[model samples]
Target: MSEVQQARPTLLYVDDEDMARKYFARAVGSEYEVLLAASAEEAIATLATDGARIAVLVTDFRMPGRDGGELLREVAQLYPQIVRILVTAYADKDMLLQTVNSGEVFRILEKPLSVAQVREVLRLAGERHRERALRQHRLMAIDETLAFLAHELNTPLAAIANFARGIESRVAGEYTEQRQGEIGQAASAMHDNAQYCLAVLSSFLQSVRNSAGSKAARPEPGAEVSAGALVASLLDTYPFSGDQRQWVQVEMHGDFPVQTLPNCVALVLSSVMSNALRALAGTPSPALRFVVVAQPHLEIHISDNGPGIPPEVMERLLVDPVTTHASAGGSGLGMIFCNRVMQSFGGGIRIASASGAGTTVTLDFPSFKNRMIRSDR
Candidate 1:
């Protein structure tokens, strides 16, 4: 066998008939490392010995002395990741329904199985098995990397925060009123930025830690906050480069009070802003327009004049991590993370874009009354 064939996941096929087992192995042996057993008991023993290497399991449902349904139930409990497919000549609808309802089988194949049918079924099963394994591996890798990055960032962030505070204190005490006005503004900006960084770091670390474990992370319950104030604070504290800060504008329509976790909201807005800045990197005159409209529902729209998202990418942007600029260190997790946070709050995010026109991301928050109703429920 070639190295590629040897690396293929093993597919276990069980049947009582010699011809069926031999036919299956002959048909799928080239695509997968095929394992054959004559009975359910033999299949069970094989699985017990080498189940970890087996990605897909195909078994005849009518095997004597321990049927496929019972064996599948056992496999579901013992090796849940293995994709199970049932092949049977029997027209027992109830047994097939039970097998499917119990979620013990990935697919059902009726017999006198042709080579073409078996090949297609095995192909789908193999694809599913590989996809599940790859997803699990990626998640594990992301969790470990994020945990390490969070730990390394904590100490330096704390030191920088402390230093910013010291600068503010010294400026207040040593400088005259006139000098303090000019120097204190810079010190206060530094202090504000440091505090914002700490807040973002804490929120991100907590989110990663929560996801790494089995339990889902719940957002802190609502707090009454001024929506206008929250947006203004995020805009002021975001680390904008020279001439970039001048290109952004914010407008608040009316008094907007929202009841939600401020830090979560801030993180979402910051991520949107960060993406906008990155997209507008090479534009001649980039501009960001932010508008907050308070009414039946709270709507915050952030529009940027930059190269818009491509059609193919915009379709699955939130569903997966995809970046147009991978060379610039974009993992494409920002929008996905923001979407999850919004879902936790019973809110949602929407993106509208056209190629070369620009992109506008809208954040919709549940109204105050609706938030209260949700909390009460």
Candidate 2:
């Protein structure tokens, strides 16, 4: 390997002045791998070369063609990990200030620059670049894992739900009353749990796909949706019977108000409520409650008065990549998906519960812009 490859770090210097470029190369060459480019175009071309690690960019404010400010803007947008530094003369004070205000350049070194001062700035900039690269790598890894795991898990989960529904129907229709009840209950429970898993898996998959590439398709900017109506529609279509409804008391609190960004908010709320409904078993006073507070943000709080998240499993509920620490009934994908959905829409969820104090998950999505909405009778 060349000495530059095994050296401390590499600095890319872009300037039109051959004398200044030679001077800079000599000043910093011993301590660093100085890649000299006479113009912004050459700097970009050099940056594109394979295995060319340009930690810090030092470019003159005034170049023959594209100036440092213009070149740094493109670099920041494209390879944001590379730190940008503008070198300006005493005459270019106005241009330097303009570049700084535009947030294009990280720092500006005026002419008559000392070697030691330039070295210090380059050191700091290189460190910042490395930190940013690390963060980007981590985010990329998370997105990839989300896609693979969610897609792989969805197939088996769908099959389990289908078979459970089939068994439930056969038992309920053909089996003896005594045995049918037991078999029917088991199948129903399995189907509900599987459906819950599917919802969680699908939500995560959607969020990852959305974040990985283009922006998520936003719903129409302005549309009033009745929260109450949305809830009623889903409840009517959801495959649940009167007996199941009787087993759990479902309460929709507050005079429901119309909210903007309604679809995204509603989908998250419904998923959380559905998960709560599934967890409403093997506990006294099995009930799922929804309390919608319309304020700064459209707040939807769903709570279940079940055994609540156990101390051992509560922390792992939504934090882990795959949370299997939930109750033995359903897959823990529900909370994971819910959290990701909240985060994607510039929203988030807050968890509140003690060991027996029934878990409450609150979702807060952006509210309607400058529009006052009243509850419809």
Quantify all predictions' global Cα lDDT against the true fold.
0.75, 0.66
* Per-residue lDDT over 1-377 for candidate 1, one digit per residue giving the tens place of the 0 to 100 score: 65553486798999999998888888888878999999888988897677778889999988779888878876765565689999989898888777776667999998888888888888898899878678656656655675577678877877876786677678876878989877766665565445445555655455444334332111122223466766677665555656888879988887565445455676687778777877897888899988898766788999999999999999989899997756544677878999898877678899999789999999988774433333222
Off by over 4 Å in 2: 1-8, 50-52, 91-98, 144-152, 175-196, 199-377
- Highest lDDT against the true fold, candidate: 1
- Overall local distance difference test of candidate 2: 0.66
| Candidate 1 collision pairs | none
User: What's the CA error at residue 234 for candidate 2, in Å?
Assistant: 21
- Per-residue lDDT over 1-377 for candidate 2, one digit per residue giving the tens place of the 0 to 100 score: 65555556777898898999999999988877889899989988887761136678889978788777778776654555677898988575566656676556788898988988998888788788778667766656766775687689889988999999899778865778999988887887787777765765555455444334421211122222455555554454444534555543334554343432333444576577666665565676677766666544566677788667666677777786444323346556667877886787566888887677888988766543322121100
The best candidate by TM-score is 2
How do the predictions measure up, each by TM-score? 0.43, 0.52
